[model samples]
Target: MAALEPERAKLDTTIPNESRIADYFLGGKDNFAADRAAAEHALTIAPELPALSREGRRFLRRAVRFLAGEAGIRQFVDIGCGLPTQGNVHEIAHSVAPDARVVYVDHDPMTVVHGQALLQDNERTVVIEADARDPAALLTHPGLTSVIDLDRPVAILLFAVLHCVPDDDLATHIVTHLRKAIAPGSYLALSHPVSDLCPEKTAKLAAVYQAQGTITGGRRGNLRTKAEVERFFDGLDLVEPGVVYTPLWRPGEETPHRPDATWVVGGVGRKPRRPREHPALT
Candidate 1:
């Protein structure tokens, strides 16, 4: 708790924090009055906000399982990881592979504090306070590299986070920068709310969220079109059924109804391995 004083000092309970609002949407009690009010206001615009939140979590679970189970990846770096909730990255990854190592990064001070407290006893996971827009700093942070090796094949999760980067150029830079750092065969999994599903409705919803502000300084929410979201995976090999609606990504069975309500597209892409060098003939 001594570490919480500084983190708490940096917080403003009056302005709704994006992570806390997300927690409220997921039926968590860690939010303040401002967070609740903002979430309620957003619900008036899009009544399906809560459901979309749940669907997002489902996509995250499925994606994590695929990475730690099928892809055989043991290292994970989950950036912009919001408040801890059920089926967290480490919990899901550890279920498949007990040896899996995970590092959760978030810019929110409270989120980092809470995550640190919750994960204190868990040796396999650690949380650090870092901005997603600055990929270099967060990627190279001693706290992050300590848990997961950047040189190895690591799975980077960006679930419901990038839209916070209002600047398209910065978003592109963040993803491309990260892609360059990871070794060949590393994976990137992301889910983003898209404007392609219902442009007018999403636009209004975006307006509502903008009014309340976000964690990424003064920049408002930027809901990208499905095509724009897919561009984040450039230079990587997309897994099967690339960048589809959240529930449709790999639902297997028990598919959720009206997946379009989620208004989000998700996909997993792997960095292709380098071709072996040719031997010099004698």
Candidate 2:
């Protein structure tokens, strides 16, 4: 394990972090009072928050399994990896390919600590403390580079985290940088909250998150539309059934799409083997 920087080791229990609050929503006890308070408040707005969390996690597991089992992607760079939970990216990927490598990135100190503990014995996994806003910093981090091979196909997992990024241009830039760093045939699996599912409820919930000082609230941290979310996959080949609700994205069981249950939208896309040529080209 790499040595933790003093700055990254500090844990502030006063302010509620989105990752801890999310853990609270998922029924995890590794959270502070601030986290639970914020989660409770958010729940008042969107009553289905807990369900959304569970479904999002399930979507992550299924997506990772698909990437590893079917896509044959053995390396994963899971950005904004929330509190260490069961069946994480590495756990799912390694289950299919023991040699699979994963680098978990998050700005939360608790997340890093918990993730490090959970992945202690797993030599193929490494947890790095870094802000998701800076893809270059994460991509070039010593811990990540040690395990993840940029030259090979890597699955960039951006599950339920992009909303934390407030700036649209910055968010797009980060994705672009990461996509550019990876080789052809790499994959990107992402899930994000959408306001369109339950506009009223989501709007109210955004207020709760804002009051708690969570990253996304107000104009900065609200949910995005389906078309806006699709922009993240620019220049990539979306997998079949692209950009749909979590439950409907290649569901494991015979579950029908619930257009109303719109907390999250998720999909997988593959980087093409060759760059698209301009129409004016020969």
Q: Summing lDDT over every window of 10 consecutive residues in candidate 2, give the lowest-scoring window.
A: 1-10
How much lDDT does candidate 1 score? Answer: 0.83
**Residue 235 lDDT, candidate 2, scale 0-100:** 81
Q: Estimated TM-score per prediction?
A: 0.91, 0.91
Model 1 misplacement above 4 A: 1-9, 215-222, 275-282
Can you write out model 1's per-residue Cα lDDT over 162-184, one digit (the tens) per residue? 87765677787788888888888
Which has the greatest TM-score? 1
lDDT of 2 at 261: 76
Q: What lDDT tens digits, residue by residue, belong to model 2 across residues 1-282?
A: 112233532577877888898888887889998888788877777788788888888889889989999999999999989998777788788889888999999888889999999888989999999876667888889999999889989999999988766467777777788777778899999999987767777667666666666663224535677788898888889998999888888886746445467568999989888846512111
Give per-residue lDDT, candidate 2, residue 156: 95
Q: 125, model 2: CA deviation in Å?
A: 0.7
